[model samples]
Structure formats: structure tokens, C-alpha cells
Target: MNPLNPLTPQDAPTPAPGVYVPGYARAKLGMIAAGLLLMGLGFSQFAEPLRLLLFGERARAEAVRVVKTKEGLPDQVLESDRQVTAALEPRDRSYTFWNEFRFADGQGSSFEVRAPVGSQLKPLYPLIDEEGLPTTDLVVYDRAHPERSAFPMIVSTWFAPGMLFVIGTLCAFIGSFLFYWAKKPIELPRLPPTAPATSTEKD
Candidate 1:
């Protein structure tokens, strides 16, 4: 018999790792990664339409798409609503805009962009819906110079705080659960025994 073996006659069961073990850390990491992915997606949607103006003439020459009518004619080619964002230098908050395009047989509908909350939102605009469309600016220059028709523009926008808040709440909830499972249970308090009625010495 091995002296090191504590069990006399039977095999002892092995104890599993606690909830706070490395396994839990790995699980939390996975959750964090997923959270980051969601956060990234939200941010990606916001970083579009960075002003092409920043690019030099050589880069601008490389600009692929020609800026046609900003607002497409009503009842024309229907376009899905697109989102764009900008987080410029020195600014704590970011900006988000919803833009869309549509046109019809001959007449075209104006493309509109909206910002839910931003300093540039002088006249409130709503996101385009299936029912109808909104107004937009369409600059027309010389007919021969279609290239000049394309213009660099910015959509009204505001900071994206909702995603950060949601991510924070999820992390806190998961972290708390892991911590709770790893904690040891508390011991119950002892109660005082009731004193039995006995004859007093004087009595």
C-alpha cells in the first residue's frame, strides 16, 4: 500500500476547478470578443463619408464615383438607406447620418440625409421610409463639366453613446455572475439557548 494514498480501500474522487478558474477567464474573454465585434460594427457604420476634400488633387482624381444628383427623382430607382459617421480631431462626440436615394420615370425624388442629434441639425429631418422621401441639395454646373457637379458634403450627426452603455452593462452582468459562483457560502449565525426556569437559591 502506498503511504501517500489517503484513501484506505477506495479511489478518491478528484475535485474540479472552481468557477473563477482559467476556464472562466477564457469564457469571459470570448464574451468580450463578441462584445468588441458588435461595438466595431456600430463604429464602422459611423466612419463613412469622410470628407474627400482632405485628399489632394491627385487623390481626388482617383475618386471613383461621380457625384450626380444628390437627391434622386421620385418614383425612380429605389435605394436602401445608408449610414455615415465622422469622429474628427478634438471632438469627444461623433456624428451619424442616414442617407438614401430614389428616382422615377422622368422626374426624380430628392435624396435626404438626417441627423437625430447634432449641432448642424437646424431644420429637423427624419430617416427615409418606404412611404415617401425627403428633400436634398442638387448642384448643377456646366453640362460639359459633369466632374465638377460632384461635390463634397457632410451629413448632420451626433455622438454614439448607446452602444458603449450596452457593452458596459453586459460586461458587468457577466463578471458578477462569474464572481458569485466562485465565492464560498457564508456560515449561519449561532442562536443563544433558551434559559430553563429553575428554582432560585432564595426561593
Candidate 2:
């Protein structure tokens, strides 16, 4: 006899078979990891810019001025190696170029430094350009180390890392929600047809 409802011929409710969604589970896990990595990388990228912003005055104090030797412009300007289809693609490009910053150490040893192609740094002293000769002084680190070299920060640097951070965060949130909230598809059991009824009479 049916315990819940005796009037109707109904099967007892049972749990449906479990679904093995391997891909879904894997994706969810991947998202979590990707999110963490992206966030970490994004924060790491900001380290130098933030530091410079906070203590630029102190860093400037420690920097030493070095002279630029070349006249007119530095000879590093060359045709864009990047091949574009259009001939009139505004080919003129100016890159920040400078001579190596050399300074004397406390022990009378001299050290030289050349800032990279697109650094936005100026010397502590005024640039000296006279007669047809162009010369500029640059302020750079008094000392050099493996991790600490002066490089200018640009807008593009923040774009990719910031995007990764945002995208990763979104992916992680979506993955976590799916992991906790998504319901599996269930397969219900089929019910058998009832047999035909027959009547009997007694005389």
C-alpha cells in the first residue's frame, strides 16, 4: 500500500541518477586559479609605478646627473620594422634617447648607465645645447643593481595587466557561483502501464 496517498497509484519519489559533468567541474576549478594568478600579476605590475609615485622626491635626491654627448638628435631613430600595408601611415616616430649616466662612487670608481629607448626622464641639471651641438643632462640612479634600474612608466603598461585582473576576477566569480549553484540534470524512471481489468459473475 502507498503510505503517502492510497487513492492514487503512484511510485515513491526517488533521487535521479547523478550526472558526471567533468568539463564543467574542470572549468570552474581553472577559473579560480586563473583569477588568483591574474590578480597577483596585476598587483605586481603596479609595484614600481606606485613606489615612484609615493617617494619620487627621495629617489630624485639619490639620482646623479649625467651629460648627453651627441649633437642634434641621437642616431638611434630608424624606420619602423613593423610592416603595415598603408604607405601613408604617419611614419614619423620620436623615441626618447639618452646617453649613459656615469657617476663616481665613494671609492672613486666610475659607473655608466644608459636608460632604455622610451624612458621619460630628464636630468637634474639643465640641458646644454649650444651652437649646432645638442646636449642634455640626465638624472639617473647613483648606483646600479640587478633589480633596481630607472625605467619610465607608460599608460600601455597598465592596460593588459589591469584587463587580466578584471577578467580573471570575473571568471573566478562565475566559476564559484556555478560550482555552488548549478543543478545537475536528472533522469526520471519510466512508469509501467496498468493491466486491463476483467469482471466475473456467479449464478
Candidate 3:
């Protein structure tokens, strides 16, 4: 038996002399494009306009009136009255809550504000006293325009952008791997047949 020849075919086919174009090239390009897109999306999160577009007025509003008192402590609180319409049935009736607060310009006024039911970072609803009074301060933009207001939610502020950035980074990483994989060449499975050996020694 020939030592050079194996029981199974060991030779692999040779490809054209130039650098090989991987079969997955298109897929790699797609991945690269997707990665770039995700990177762009991540960058957009830091932009003010995108933040405003995604988070709305809350992104630019100034927060105020945070309650600092601990449990069972005496604290001064603002009044937030529930305004409900009796025209409809109990379940069907609509209610509007309002809180009275003084503007920074030394003008005392009342703006509609509501406490959040639950939140991750900060409470959406204001801390209230025993008499349904607001215990916490709220965010405000223009004191003159109370209608443009909202309860603070950290998800829109910190969580959303952070999560988006993380996801985008992961996507970019995966995309880079795919791009590298696609750029790598695959060798052909076929190899050229070997020629008969000739003796180099003199006869």
C-alpha cells in the first residue's frame, strides 16, 4: 500500500489564485449594515431632539418639590384634590386631580399633577399626606402653562436610552463577527491528482 495515499480522499480542490470571495459575503454585508444601523441608533439616543421625540416634554422639564421627610415625620404637604364628575356612573365618571404649588417666581398657583401608581427609578405619583395632600414636589417647565405637564417616569429618562444603547452595542458586536466571518475565505474541497514519482538518483 502506498504511504502517500490514504484510505479516504485527503486532497482538497484548489480554488482560483485570487483572494476567495466567501459564499456568505452578502450575509456578512447585511450584518455589517445592520451593525452600523444599530450603532447609529445607539448614538441617536444621546441627541436632545431624539430624546424629546421619544420622551416628549418630560425630557426637558425641571423637577421640583421632592419630599424629604422620612416615615412618621411631620412634614408640610401641598393639597391635591380629586375633581370628579357626578354626571356619569361611579365607574364611568371621569376624574381630574390637581395640586397647588408656588412657582419659582414667587407666584402661588395650582397645577394638575398626579402620583404614579408604581415606578422603577422614581415614583410617578407624588407622596401624599393623610389628607390626600401631595407630599412630594413635581417637575415643571413653564409655570404659566400648567397644561403641559406629566408625572415623572425614569423609564423614559434613563432606562429606555440605556437599554437601547445596550441592545445596539450587542447588535454591533454580533454584526462585526458576521462581517469577519463573511470576509474569511473558504478553501475548495477538490485537489489536483499527483503525478508518478521519478527517481532522482542515477541509474
Question: How large is the C-alpha RMSD of every model relative to the true structure?
Answer: 15.7, 13.7, 13.5
- Model 3, 49-117: lDDT tens digits are 343335443322222333222235453342222211211123421322233333232244444433322
lDDT assessment of candidate 3 = 0.43
Identify the leading candidate in terms of lDDT. Answer: 2
Q: Per-prediction TM-score, please?
A: 0.27, 0.39, 0.39
The TM-score measured for candidate 2 stands at 0.39
Once superposed on the true structure, which residue ranges of model 2 sit more than 4 Å away at CA?
1-23, 55-153, 183-203
Model 2 scores worst on lDDT over the 10 consecutive residues at 78-87
By lDDT, highest first, what's the ranking? 2, 3, 1
lDDT of 1 by residue, 16-50 (tens): 32211222444555666666665665555443322
Ten-residue stretch with the least lDDT total in model 3: 79-88
| lDDT tens per residue, model 2, 3-23 | 322332122232233322222
lDDT of 2: 0.43
